[model samples]
Target chain A: MSFRLALQESPGNPWFSWRYVQDNSDTILAALREHAILTAEAMLIATAVAVPLAVVAYWYRPLTGPILALSGVLYTIPSLALLAFVAPYVGTTNPGSVLIALVLYALLLIVRNSLAGLNQVPPEARDAAQGMGYGRWGRLFRIDLPLALPGIVTGLRLATVSTVALVTVGALIGHGGLGDLILTGFRNNFYKAEILTGAVLCVVLALVLDLLLAMAGRLLTPWSRRAVR
Target chain B: MRSENPIQQALTWLNDPLNWTNPGGILDRLGEHLWISAAAVALGCVVAWPIGMWLGHAGRGGSLVVLISNLTLAIPTIALLTILPLTFLGFGKPPVVVALAVFAVPPLLANAYTGVRSIDPEARDAARGMGLSGWQVLGRVELPLAVPYLAAGFRTASVQVVATAALASFVNGGGLGQIISAGFGLGISVGGGQILAGGFLVALLAMLVEAVLAVVERVVTPKPLRKARGRAARRAAVATGSA
Candidate 1:
């Protein structure tokens, strides 16, 4: 309550003016929190759906084309257009509209990467698993998924980063993460502090999340680095 | 009796001839969207392609590519555009162009680097053995070999940019997003039509880019390499099927 956005927007102030931090600390933090939460939620949901769809597509080869094609076409739709297109159907106020679009954007990356990761498991590895009496589901989870971890993580990283960026576009639909601050500033005669703060927070958030994901990828697949050494 | 569906209402409005002929009509919006996307892609190539080729040729700075790519992903372009006006860059097309250009770079860089790196070592050696300079080797051998990847990269970058260029409207850069944004203000029944028209154009732009690039990819891939690559792919498909 005390930390509402700063009242005085210094448009003439330098972009990096210290005044932004002094004035709009609360708004910046709130936007950051919202952005992070939405992005994370979207990625998690995308992964949940995409990974399984990819698995099914891999299992049934004929499905791959249709499955990937759907996402590919969806990917071409502009973020703004998609938001507006859905706004009528879902009600403009529904955050689900934005979340749904973000999820769609993430799907192609997630599915394609998951498939690539699964494909990366050498045939011999699969043979070894089968020979070792691993059942189908057991082998998929234990052998295939672990081996594909690096690839899947790569997809997740890509999707997460893009989602983080696109989530800002959601501001147009009333659910824009840090995008709201930027839009707020833009609408209110270019409130420089809000715009600058929003932009900086988004970049910082993307970098931090990207790094964290990379580290997580490394941790998940420790042996990936070993082959080089 | 006609349905008062918002989408239908919008379509009816879209049918008006005024939209097609006016100064701020659909055709103008289409032109703006195309120019913005094209400019972004062209500038992106100028900046990113050479860096990628250099990294690929050197076979170094792998981590540098990763960091740059991450930075590209992390920067929220729409937000960045809003901030740019306050900086020395000032407002309008410059900021929009810069943001879109930055967004377009990563794919080009990554693909160019990878395309070169994926060249056959034996082929590279033969080029060198034939008295080719490093640049000659790159131009004569690696460039042709990398055609498919380059096309693929361009296709991806262009498609994404075209879609993203819709955001230029937010900054008054003027593109198909104007229709969508305008539609939002016009309300559900009437505005929905404008939004649909804009989205349709943007999506069409992406699909067109993809289709053209796919054709170029097929045509420019060195014939022998394409045949060999095709065979290898078929073999892999067979193997996957059997497995």
Candidate 2:
């Protein structure tokens, strides 16, 4: 009993426990801030660019192939390689460069989902809207967008999670959020506390973001949640 | 601001014969990168494939599998790689392999499960009606139908492994990242060029892997399934599966 108690009480053995976590609150919070800022900026930018382009593709039809192809090619680039590739041009410290690269990743995901969301809007709903005197633009804004919300949220959720992972790769850019601690630990001053804290905090941040988004999606799109539920 | 001529330097870097033949040269590094990445993918398959297959065959836990895969996907690979060395792993290729394999599992499991679950219920019913036992139905029908999805998953895992394997250099695990990090270690100038050169190599390899896997996916999908499965369709299959 004493041996088990001593082992459990050891700070190293209980790294993730409430006791140990409090000791590293500062380190954890810094990483959480970096992770959140980069993720939000990237998602916001990707959504802004992707929705318009998706609308254009939906409207034009011809550009669909090209847009898809371009995004597909970009997606094939390794996340780390993209960071390393861009680090030289952007300088390591600027978060904008990381944001730009991360935004490129969300492009394909958001665009496809946007288009799918719009497309998946039942023809009946649009027809019913038109019959009720909703004009083209009004139909899109009032009917299509709302109906498409579920899928777009789904896409956004995915983009957010993916970007979370990529932010660590951003460490190479020297703007990396939780990644800097891990990389610093790996390279110069090897410390289990920093590495463990960073890893745990990064994962926790992702989980929190994921839960928040999922809850937000459910709350905002009650209609879709009904269907899904 | 685009100041450096990384493309030109990358070209020169590639053209130089010395880079290929020297000890720890590009060729050796390339080989090391491939096998190690491949090994990680293999390890991922070993872990994920059975669970995926069992869940997929039972037509159960699709949502659970997907949920777990999503959670797994959210973990930063660099964080995994870094923290692993602190967990009795120490800095080396083994840690790299473990980290890469951890990241690789989600895609593998998600696609495999999705592939099986996506099959027409009628087909499963027909196979059962035809006097096939559970094992027989799975072996003869569902697993075959899942080949394309499995292939797609493997491809995603392999490419991601190859691309990120460059990070192994951070832990003194040798790969092309060694050269790229050396460039960054210098802070600018020649480093910029090497980073680009290194990135281009990694990107090109990822594309090549993706292209090859695409062809394999096309070939493996049964002809009728292939009829509806274009590049976009295949991509949607893998994306929504993992998503």
Candidate 3:
């Protein structure tokens, strides 16, 4: 029983029932926008760095082992530990901290898939392209790339889902979006509908994102459609 | 119990069961976390197993499903945990469980699906030729064959759930996370030690599960693979001797 609630719900009640939900909707919405943008930016950054590295690593198998091993070690580190480790360089409250972690997590997937996809290309196909007087770049684009598209797309799809989910961790830093609502519910002492609402929305976001990625994978790999039949 | 002894004082405070009282106390909280994780993983396996089986039979869809599941692997549980309380309105095990299930689903589904899809075409065709119905064939042939893969999936999901369940503390759902979080309170050594212990305990529980499953996997591996493995070992020994 607080003052705010007594004024609104029951005059005798003293509880100040602040409508956190009402007050925070706009903030959450704004955070979602930032989250989406952050995810996209991180993916772009990670791809730009990882894909070329993967290609070069593919050409030299020795580098692939070390890069992959590094990614595996990165994977073992808990997300919070990684964030706290890097908090000094980039303020934790900012979107950049979470975004950077997301990119790091994604690098392994992108690099592994890229290298695997490239290696999966039939050697004869590349030979044929080379025989056609295609240089290294031409062979890569014309012959090797199309074959590897499926794996690359697979990696990107993985990276996207991961980034979207990870962006919520940024909420601890006072970044908005659903995480803000959930964290508030937590700090406010107990379960209220507001917290559950945010969580459900996040799960829905994940499920919807998963389906969209699946559709995208299908579209990207037309060959798969035939292979299924 | 009040003493000038620093080490004894810390030990008594830590060992005191009375410290963990209240509604969301330490011991009760750890129990809640395990319960939630166990429930969610059990439920996830039920859903994932069938989907995995169906996907395995459906060829072409294998990579696509794998791709989708892999993507889900990317979404951090912490983010999901954070968003859950807000969207679901007041955090509890339900949202946490859902988040965990999403995390656990990919490995189970992917492994189960791959197991079925990767079954020898000859074996499937032979089963079909014997007039065995699709369901029967799947039950008798496909499933037993896929056990090793399913076990692998289960192993991955189990460890994942245990580790991620720590996030449940963020939303006040209580678990080992509360102990860990409480350790962050004051005296860094006191708090940090608790957190370390809780993390170690969770890791140990997860490893125990993995080891038990590894035994099951070893048992499930076909006799031929075991025989071949022995032969390979013998050949290696002989080659080394000759060299």
Identify the CAPRI category of the predicted complex in candidate 2: acceptable
User: Residue B93 in candidate 3 has what lDDT?
Assistant: 65
Model 2 chain B poorest 10 in a row by lDDT: B234-243
Instruction: State in Å the error of residue A54, model 3.
Output: 1.9
- In model 1 chain A, the worst 10-residue window by lDDT is A1-10
Poorest 10 consecutive residues by lDDT, candidate 3 chain B: B234-243
Considering DockQ, which of the candidate structures 1 and 3 is the better prediction for this target?
1
Per-model i-RMS in Å? 8.9, 6.3, 10.4
Q: State residue B66's C-alpha deviation in candidate 3, in Å.
A: 6.6
Q: Is the docking of candidate 3 incorrect, acceptable, medium or high quality?
A: incorrect
What TM-score is obtained for chain B in each of the predicted models? 0.87, 0.88, 0.78
A1-229: candidate 1 lDDT, tens digit per residue = 1211332344464556677787877877788888999999899999999999989888899998899788767777777777876777776667888898888888988888788888879999999999999998999999999998887887887788789888998887668889998898888876766787788788888778878998998888888888636
**Model 1 CAPRI quality:** acceptable
Q: Count of backbone clashes for each model?
A: 2, 1, 34
Tens digit per residue, CA lDDT, model 3, A72-115: 55544444444433443465356676777777867876777777
Q: Poorest 10 consecutive residues of model 1 chain B by lDDT?
A: B234-243
Order of the predicted models by lDDT, top scorer first? 1, 2, 3
lDDT of 3 by residue, B1-243 (tens): 223333343345557677566566556765786798898789889989998898787665666665556556544566566555444233456777887887788777777776787678999999999999989888988998777667667766776676667667666566666654454443333443454444444545555665676577668767665554333322221111100
